[model samples]
Target: MTLAPAPKPAVAPPSPHPRRWAGLAVLSASLLLVVMDMTILNVALPAVSADLRPGAVELLWMVDVYSLVVSGLLVTVSALGDRWGRKRTLLTGFTIFGLASTAVLWAGSPGEVIAVRALLGVGGAMIMPSTLSMIRTLFTDARERATALGVWSAMASLGAALGPILGGLLLEHFSWHAAFLVNVPVMVVAIVAGLLLLPESRNPAPGRWDAFGTVLSIAGMVALVYSIKQFGKEGAAGPGPWIALAVAAVTLTWFVRRCLGRPDPLLEVRLFRSRPFTAGTLVAVTTSIAMAAVMLLMAQWMQLVQGHSPLETGMRLLPTALGALLMSPPAPWLAARFGTRPVLAGGLAVSGLGLGLLPAVPATYPWIALSLFLLGLGMGSLAIASVAIMAGTPPQKAGSAAAIEETSYELGGALGVAVLGSLAAVVYRGALPPAPAGGGLPGPAADAVRESLGGALEVARQAGAAGAELARQAKAAFTTSLEVTGLAGGLLMLAAALAVWWLVPRDLDVTASHH
Candidate 1:
């Protein structure tokens, strides 16, 4: 008798462990340090410039090199972690990051500082991918995974908001070096806790490292980001900037072609064929661009024009941090009940509305807090929803998917600063009349004149009443330029919302699985 096939072995649900939560805490803390560093230095840039005395070109490099390096290496380092053990790579990254922070703290010149920051980026590239990849290994249940991701997203948002505040406090009490030194203590704790709590996990069928792909990816990103940086400083239509951009396009095209032909590729290009993955990536990219530009422009407005201290600026931004924190807990439940499409579309539209109000900000506006709160709420909802879609992808492809999401986020930020910043620059330039005959000023004061109306006023204030008229004109011009930039950002965010509505699917889970 054909024996009834042995009853299929019962599949057991993954066992929940208390230690997993501890591991998450350790990972989140490490991630927070990296996120904090990105913005903390913005407040410290002037100090750094004074101490190092870097030239104009060197100053820009010192500020941007870290992000450029990090953006270039993320995919390569992520692929490395998938092949090697993610836990092992993460621990190594933490150790390197600590050492690099120490190097940055002791740096004597602009070149030295730039080198150390770039090293930090290399370490960060290793750390970033491991955090998300580890979550996949630790939590197998969908609901639990979503909850953990929500917490992770909140920590990232909080770290970003807290960076300037933390930097300001350190700068007030100590030297500029304090910013880099601060990471050492945090890294020590992370390394110790991570070693004890984090479990080792690696891909079962991880392919060999693709060295050519690595080179191509790095070359393409650096070229593209560098070109954009040049365009912002110059103009996109400039011949030199166009040449750099063309080189970037060629390198990226080569990289894509290489990936398509490889039996085992560094990045899986096939994943983009999935509608959910593609749409989620687009949303992540566009939202990040819009948000980053707004934050940079608003921070400059608050500090340079409104004359708020860093701490005061951060306090004013509490609406954003609190909004994100409050919205995170309910994201998973909302997505499950209402579907990702509605949530993403609604979140983007709400964020657009919030941004739209900024252009109308009155000199005596009392509703600043409320308007910012709305913006924060919308950003929080969109961030959580986009991340959920990304994380829901299949396990085997998780590393590549995470890399794509991160690449889009970082690239978008770079582009935002480049494109939107250029718009602001143009308006600012046009608002100012050319300097009068015999109005020649020294380079430092001249730069101050170019940056803000307050700087111009301060110059005029020191120069006496003869310069008062020029200062008034500068103030009016600067205010008008800021207004124009704010309106442009709002319109861009609205456009992004429409893009999301058209592209993202109604059901993330089904789309993820099918695609």
Candidate 2:
């Protein structure tokens, strides 16, 4: 035995698998599908509305239900992925997405389409978490991980930009059904490729999946988002929204308390003890807040104000997406060279300056394009924000960290739409010169004109010269609102940059293992 032991020679342990890059491609495709679905409907809404003929409330639900479902389930599905397998969860999500997207072919009614979208949301919830968590596992090196996340962020930017373009093209040739159908082919490829290329990864010692925490998280997020949506549309006049907000507050607070008390929490709240994590979360929140509502308003401006077709609108928006596509991939390299604090803060400042210029852009088309390009360039720093998030989290908590970052984004967007939209509405309403006393507009039509620029345009078309004048008035008011919104958004970006600069540590290494 002693002789045998002496004869034993050292042998090297196996190296990490070499297929991570291929796995990333698969994950990026899935993420694109999820994100593209969110924006595809924007350009298709009119077509869908014409076909489905859903009522006002139903139309809103159709547009918003997907986001609500996606936001509500992100945390629950992420935890489930850890308890099960990340790759398994991702595949299951892809299956659900494919089947549901295919089911869209059968959807005839508004309710059915909403149901399909909700199901897609369920699939999205499952897919999103798995992608980020798997990336953390696939790329063990920090530099590699940062690059992977850059690609990940680029896909997201590309997806959001891609949706409207693809939808516009599809709607030009086919029915609204083509929008959902497009998801099926991409998903089928994703599913097959995923099974072959994506390796299985999960928490080696993931404790119990907290059922209560899941319920709390889902309910709280859903209620919060619903309330925000209601506020955006109807403001705080209703007790319903306020009550929902209260419930969200209570449930989320209790959920947080439970997380803190547990030895192994569903979400690792304590990880936020690190400066980088907190700063990253803040960046996610602020950037989303500054961008989401403005983009929505701009889209309306392009179509309702400028009278552009959906295809034209998509084309006009291309500069923003192109800028993001160009910037996000290189963001990691820039951060690696200059450090995250400067890049992230500088990006925010640049974004802010770009946004500030939005209010001053001449109404001409070329100026608008220039403003959008600069805005995209500024927002591209989002790639660095993602790096900050993963750098601060331990590998074991990748799913949790991803869930939190996503939650911030979702909620921030909701808040942005609700809060800033309300502001725009206020400005629009205020700027509306008392209906030209002699515009010959009906009392009901006059009320409609006051509601929104779109309403004004429709009323104007029917009211003759007076209607034309009213359309001009409404448009001018809308333009003012946009200018105000742009300035507000700019200020927010600048503030975020300053805050991020202060929040991130000077020497934080995002590429290093948190463990």
Candidate 3:
């Protein structure tokens, strides 16, 4: 026999244990809960307004405060996770979030609700970054990591899609309080599972928590988000919004300079030097802006305009969820074959197409399912592209990378709702004639009518024939405004798609690049 070559050293096989997967399951469940809560309460806004009697500004705050705080704190909390063990930080966050949910349920005033929502945001900041960081630690094998991330992404998308359904069910059967109360059971389960299953992990070079950076980040984000919100309410050129934006710019500039000088910064500004990373971040931001506004508008149309019960409205959205579910499983395969850039660009175009179709959906259109399915399919593709980008990032910097990605998501969403929602409000007001001075309306009711479409409708419903005519006119105006808003959102998505085509490389494999 030909001198047998020395047997090659055997390579060790991967671990067969299920514990690692269980850890991911626990983390994914926690993430699902956090993301679901972000939008579930939206469907219940009408109920909240009816019970809490919030002003227009207060109503906007109730919807946006959680996002603002979460976005502001993400970079800081993500840094904290690098210093402390990710598991410990995540568990602590879960506890805080659960308790805050209870507080939200019991909140008697709009201000109290806003405060609790902000607290929930703090917890969310800790939780979001930790989940992605833990996933990085749990799966060392590249292929396994991709699969795990796919599952996690699917759950996140599902949770967002399901929020309206769950909220609608709760509102139809119980009260608006039930929307928040629902989080309690989910959180309790997630916390228990996390403690039992999660393995602790931390960065080897965990740096000091930058307190000053934290303050600057929070202040800058709050000012920026608040300014955008104000711009939506008062227009972008308004003096008040302009002032807020200027403050935000100054604070952010200072924060960036401070980070550049620090040896170990809270947010590593160097990350953006990577073209792929920067492009990915831009894609995430624009995709969120494109989709979030549509979700908000659709919810309003289903509940306030069409008079559909919350449960019924949610049921109608089932097609969108189904489409997303179907799309998620194939994401990894598509990325592997086509490469991330092409897949991402294609997805953006598809999403833009779907959004463009929305403006054509007639009031009496019976094909709601088709419209939602198309939208979901497009968005689902974009979601996979985002995951691909994150997974491609360096392991050591996963937390910061995740924070950046999430911040873009949150900021984009806030801007979308503020800008698109404001545009719709302006058009609605312009189309409707002013209410009569003494049309048997109370001062508060008349004032509210001037401010909110929903409030105006409620007033009309309760005030008799004259009020009914006013309601009719207002409804027509609202519909027209929604159509215009949808067109604007569609055009923005188209622009984003073009941006992706121009910026992202055509043949780049995100997975291979990182490896």
Candidate 4:
């Protein structure tokens, strides 16, 4: 028999775009816009409340509907990006975001504002995943990609802290409309930059885009998020929430099964079969949950208990952002020197340590500063997780991988607010003094007082001495609840760290995509 030469191993194609770093800047900037939008409402809500005079339900919808729509549409948009083109999808998103934000100038009612936010969510859903997938295609080398993700992560951390500060600054001199107006200009610039610099990429073998699968994913995610939000607000007593939860479970399970049965799935969930991808996703989810819970409670503590101004609270939050900025770039270098498994597990442990210390702090600047720094430092692992997810995924499937990672974050954040917040609520209700039905307060007011610390304070202000005493008890109860939330979050982080360590391969290469 004639000897046949063995085929040479396949090598990754050289990046088609030379202006990689510049493209990264565009991606990072786009990501910053998306992350900031999630939080910018915090300070603007009071302004909106004053201007719109919305009913309580209307106000809640205005605050929450954006996220609900974003989470709901992420999977669908990401899948479409794979079929059409990531660059094309992203630029379209920029156009929509800019137009929607600019249109906010005409918003005259709470319903109109809610519609605007939902439109913004549509743009966000399109933009967010494209950013990550574009990064995957832009940076061909692993180490360079890690560095890029470091910058991406820093921007995310910075954006969260920046939102309140920016809102406060604008609301100082301008109307609430300025908040949305800011996005318009920035998004316009991003859209133009993206068109000039970003290269088109798509799945070379993308199959039929199933509308039914898209519907299932969107419905499941929206229902699940809404169910969680309602449960957090009112606890688990309503049939509406129960029905939504059931629908979400059934719909998501069916969707997953459909993907598994397909030759070219809507999402390449089989990627999770690789332990590294699975570990990275779990880490993403865990960090998001921990950070969300911590940020919410800490912000409340600063404003309500410590009596800090909005500007002062934002300034106090700088340490956390600073720590993330300082540590993120170096994380990739550290992981390369050490092993990926060690770095990931150790980072989570350090974060858990911070959570453990939070409840014991004296609510002073120095004490809170230490915990926040630790939390940010430990968050360094998130960059590593991003690297792992992208590196492990095929370049063609970047959209699916990006969608999965972002979904983890979105769901994690929502659950964090729901589950941990609920746990804190339970502790608060239990520790609070019993609200007698007819003792110096009306039934409606008493029920309101029991609902939240903010409500308690409002009632106290109206009731004078009686309210003052109730407020005192309420603060004490809130503090106790904070303790429970912190401690429980710490335990969960520790558990996640341990689980990741055990599941991740000891010699796993975070940079190279083996699986």
Candidate 5:
């Protein structure tokens, strides 16, 4: 009996990293600022335009370049992080971000600003995936990982809620440069804290760096995003956008094939073969598509139509964050009770209901607040989606999973703004009553008015008392566009919900090790 050696006492699993929670704080705080950069820039753009007087093309580049650079570099950077230590990559990103922010002091021209933005994008690309991958490293237990992800998801909502308020406060006291400058101190702290708390992690067996694959990825991403932007600006009538799209299609296809053929690819394209990974990715993409256009429109409406100050608009947006905060922390618990499939699909349904309410309910602030709240509540399911993604992946592949998730968000947002934004523009133009025959506003002013809601408001300001009716009609038309866009987004959400229900396995257990 003694010879059996007591069956080796069923060795217990390893405990989680000692400093994981503290490390999570650093990662979440950094993520908060990264997300904040997007919304804060939106608030500061008017001030920047007034000071710099950038031409239309220059301004567009200023905005689009950051995302373009981020999208292009994400795959390569994420893979690099897997080979070169994730902690080292993240700390380097912080240094780059801090330095780039400091550069704003000397960035007097739009071109300089664009350069700074591109650099920040590089930093952001380095930072974003590393946070998720590190989370996967820090929390080995599946349930604990899910909780950490909830916190991670909630930080994004909090950052969005805070950006406008913070930006507004800064702008009132300082110049638009303050927005960029604000990143320096935060990045400094992140770098210091990350060095102390975050553990080094890498794929121990990561093979050859795919240099050609990197080129193909960067080219494909840039062309793809550029085509979407062009189509948004010029619609489907332009050959340039079509050419870009064709190039993107061919290059991306080649990239995918190359990845599949390699013993060690730049990205694990085969991750899509896993049901949970694909389902989780679909949720992320669809949620982003529904969220982006609506949030953009809402910000404009609150500021231009309702005449709210930037701070007020930011405060109004707080309900969405509040809803997310209330629901996100408990999402894993809910999933434990109901299972991942129901929780995820049900969340999408709830979000769809919220979006549908935008058109169905009265177009008042209170009703809008309610809709936003519901949207946030439903979006809490993203924590579970993330759990599914990371849990299903092998530990060595965490970087790839994180990159795919982040890329889904970026691409989905771009698609949302381009496709739904174009739809809104058409609706707005059609909804606007044409200027009275020949006796109405001058041709240039009329054209400006028809160009966008902002243009209409600006022209109205110049016209003074005579432009009241023009302003009124423009506001109404913009409202109509918002409602129509909301309806379309809601329908898309419902369709996604149905797809998720079918795709996610009913008996899937996120807590159990899958790989």
Candidate 6:
């Protein structure tokens, strides 16, 4: 047969993207800004409220609408990014974010500001998933991808920690509008850099867009988040929250069923079938719940109880970020040696121990620092969580994985604040001392003391010497509340650790291609 057909030439594996690291920098910076925007608004709200003079309902809407919109839009936007193109979607998101933030100057009313915040949410949803998916696209090597994700996770934690500090500094000198304005320059830089550095990526065979699935996702997510807010605020005081819950349950179930049935689902519901994906998601959700709630309570304790400034509170919280920063870069290497199973499970356990230590130690600044450092150290697991998730998922489904991970974060935060916050409120109310035998405080004032520590502090201030006892007791009760809540959070983290230990396979390899 003539020379036995020349030996087939070998085909080389595709080389990693040339500009991947540069692209990651742009992506990480953009992500930091978006995440920081979420918390910065919290610091700006009091000033905005003073100037806008919004009604109780209007203020609630202004605060809640941004997250509601973000939760509602993430699934739909992520699916669209997979079809349209991640780079184009991300750049467009930068434009929307810039324009929306700039529009804050003209937003005179509470409604206008709410609309502006909602627009920012839209941009956030677009930018968030695109960054993750693009990372997946750029880093073809598993080890490199894990390292990149470590950087990504570190940036996210840093952003959350930095938001309040930045907001406080801006508000110290500038108007509340400065909080919104700060985003503009960042967006401008992101858009220009993104265009130059980022590569276009899309699912090569992305199937038909799911219009009906989009509607279901939006309706389910909005209803679900709104229901959580209502229960947290009113606590079964009304039937409205229950009705929304019912709607959420039904629509979400329908959405999940639809996703599972469709070959080209709007969201990759089937990704949950992968054990590593499932374990990663569980870790993300559970850890977020504890971390978000604990951080929130600690911030309040610092400001209202310890009499620290907002900026001071933010700076104190830096230990958590510092811990994460110190540990994150080396997390992948640790996982490679120790195996992903121990790293993921041990991280949660260490975090739980941090919270557990909070209750055991004296509630002083130094003690809090020690606890926070350990907690941040535990947060380093987030990088491994990302590895497990993406490693288990196919390339085409990266957007879906990112969306699921993000949704877990958003939902977990809402749940933590709702559930754990309510628990703290109950403890605070219970721990408040009764009115003096002489009825040192009026009935309404006493009731207000029972309502919240901040309210009690105000009542204390106005009552002068009579209020001094009340203020001291209120602070003590709040400290007790934090301890109880911290314990509960610790327990939750421990439970999650136990679950993760069982869920993740013993021989799991982050570097392997699961798909």
lDDT of 3: 0.77
lDDT of 6 by residue, 1-515 (tens): 55777888787656789999999999999999998888888889999999999998999999889889889999998999999999999999999999999999999999999999999989998998889989988998898999999999999999999999998899889999999999999999999999899989999999999899999999999999999988888898899999999999999999999998989999999999888899899988988889888998999999999999888888999999999898888999999898999999999988898988877999999999999989999998767998898887777899999999989988998888888888999999887755532366778888888888888899889987777777888899999999998899889988998888899999988965432
Model 1 RMSD, rounded to 1 decimal: 2.9
**Candidate 2 residue-wise lDDT, 367-387, digit = tens:** 878877877887786788888
lDDT of each: 0.77, 0.85, 0.77, 0.86, 0.90, 0.90
**Candidate 2, residue 311: how far the Cα is off, in Å:** 1.0
Off by over 4 Å in 5: 1-12, 436-439, 513-515
Error of 6 at 500 (Å): 0.8
| Model 4 alpha-carbon drift over 4 Å, by segment | 1-16, 435-439, 512-515
RMSD of each: 2.9, 2.7, 3.8, 2.6, 1.7, 1.4
TM-score of 5: 0.97
Which segments of model 2 are wrong by more than 4 Å?
1-16, 437-439, 512-515
lDDT of 5 at 394: 81
Candidate 5 lDDT (Cα, whole model)? 0.90
List the lowest-lDDT window of 10 residues for candidate 2. 8-17
| lDDT head-to-head 4 vs 6, winner | 6
Query: Can you tell me which runs of candidate 6 are displaced by over 4 Å?
Result: 7-11, 436-440, 512-515
- Best candidate according to TM-score: 6
Per-residue C-alpha lDDT of model 4 across residues 291-352, encoded as one tens digit per residue: 88878888887788778876677788878788788888888888888888988888888888
**Per-prediction TM-score:** 0.92, 0.95, 0.89, 0.95, 0.97, 0.98
